[model samples]
Target: MINPLGRLLDENNYIVSDGAMATELEKRGVDTNSALWSAEALIKNPEAVIAVHRSYFEAGAAIATTDSYQATPQAFVEAGFTKAQGAQFITQSVQLAQAARDEYLANLPREERLAKGGALLIAGSVGPYGAYLADGSEYRGDYTLTDAQYRDFHRERMQLLADAGVDLFAFETMPNAAEVKALCGLLTDEFPGMTAWLSFSVGASSTALCDGTPLDAVATMANDCDQITAVGINCTAEENVTATLHTLTPLTAKPIIVYPNNGDIYNPIDKSWQANPNARSFAALAPEWRAAGASIIGGCCRSTPADIAGMATALAAQN
Candidate 1:
């Protein structure tokens, strides 16, 4: 049987996943400054949320990652919601993405899907524990949780989304090796019946994680975890992706998925992004990243639908 991620790659020369979620929402006039980020949109403007997913699919993203990146119950309760409410909100992310996919397909002609391998997929996003701190640590890899602590923090949400029926889980934007090891265990034992992918974030260099763990060493760490359907990078600089891929592609047989942030730089102290004026060039660079061995390609922070649409056009033209 084709592995889930393998099926996605087999269906096309390269699978184009959706672009930025939180930043895209901001462009549509949603204020994403709070700790909740895009998860805030789940409660305030769900149609706005569905619209983002639909826009990605219309622009040719075959995989629509859910807006649950920062939807942990612990964070929700910290923001004053009850445990049950947080769980419901987390589950809603899956439902909204599924609804968007159905709505998009209903208006499409059968031929486009017949040409591709299938309709769009929904990857339930699971952000790192640092995301819950809202201290900008997710990018810096400053987490200090134990293995059991990390697994406890993620298990409930993983179970919630898996039971909610997302096609796959995206353990996206992880920073440390310890958390990756713990998450791989959660996938194997806690959610043994589920499927997911693990992705790490890095700094300017490709040789090590943001926290200085050697990049390929982490991939080697999970070489035996069959449940991790794929492994790669996300929320990383566009410049660093290919170099990191060069380091990672040899460590594991799993497909390499790279969805980099626009060239803009995030300054944690200022809580501002020094915008990349050259982001328009991202589309032109997509092909090179694919050639570098990124089987799953997409955009990350600071990427808009227009950016993804342009990326879609570029990638399809190359094919």
Candidate 2:
């Protein structure tokens, strides 16, 4: 059967699912602080991760990314592992994703498999490195590493994701052109068959990434990578996505995927994340996004399964 991710690469207007973040985990009683070092929970609570995947699938997600975004070498380092020790942590993270994929496949029905063509896709999520440039131009918020150091950090993580056998390599929340270029090249060289998808964060300029890289530059870089099948923006204000769609629509022929965050960031002081975009509002934007040439849709930070379900229904109605 053709892989679902491959099918997404071939088709237009696809719906990929986004995983729940710390907010959802908090609802599940996982303290945000503890989850940082809780690698064992991925295995011990496999059900939690699988349930989230299944939720998106039921919500009409044609693709599901693995819960491996924070499994980076730098993330491990921050959680108290040495550089060498961090390598093992990253490798183990990929293995967790592989296990999740295997279980997801086992749970699917063989009779419907032919029609679905193994509709499930395990996407390995690569986020920004633990560093930044002057003037807040880092892909990640850590703001401690330089561009060259970030490249090396991503190289090691890309190798781990490649070794994990994920069907696709997705770079999410990239703030700069340099790191995005390095990641796309690294994955293409190491995993020839794996597809690449990218999502850049909206910055102060609204169109430029946090690193001051323009949307067109990001799209151009992503398209130049032979393995990149899609490129778009994520992890920004919801309204910004609509603008981004317009900015990116005319730039390239690659399919676009978007998963914007709720309008406001969640700060303990504001507690404003508790008051933000609902599923209906997010799903309601699907048609607008699709018309603007965004073929793939999903949600990002602070978005839940219900939000994904709303999007699925909206897309189905359009089709």
For 1-319, candidate 2 gives per-residue lDDT tens digits of: 1234547546634665664554565566554444242243453454555556656665666666665665666665666768777676656655655555555556669776554555556677776663212122333343444555656777777777667666677788777677777777666666666677888877645567776667788788877876887788877767777778888878888778788875555442322355653434767887788888888788877778788888778878888
Q: How far is candidate 1 from the true structure (C-alpha RMSD, Å)?
A: 1.7
Model 1 weakest 10-residue run by lDDT: 111-120
TM-score to true structure, per model: 0.95, 0.82
What candidate 1 gets wrong by more than 4 Å, as runs, is 113-117
The number of clashing residue pairs in model 1 is: 0
Over 1-319, each residue of candidate 1 has an lDDT whose tens digit, in order, gives 1256777677677888899998878877888888898899988888888999999888888888999998999989988999999999999999999888888887777885466435478898999988888877878897788999999999999999989988889999888889988999888887777778888988888888788899777898667788777889999888888788888888888888888888898886656899777654668888888888887888898887777788888888888
Local lDDT at 123 for model 1: 93
lDDT (Cα atoms) of all candidates against the true structure: 0.85, 0.65
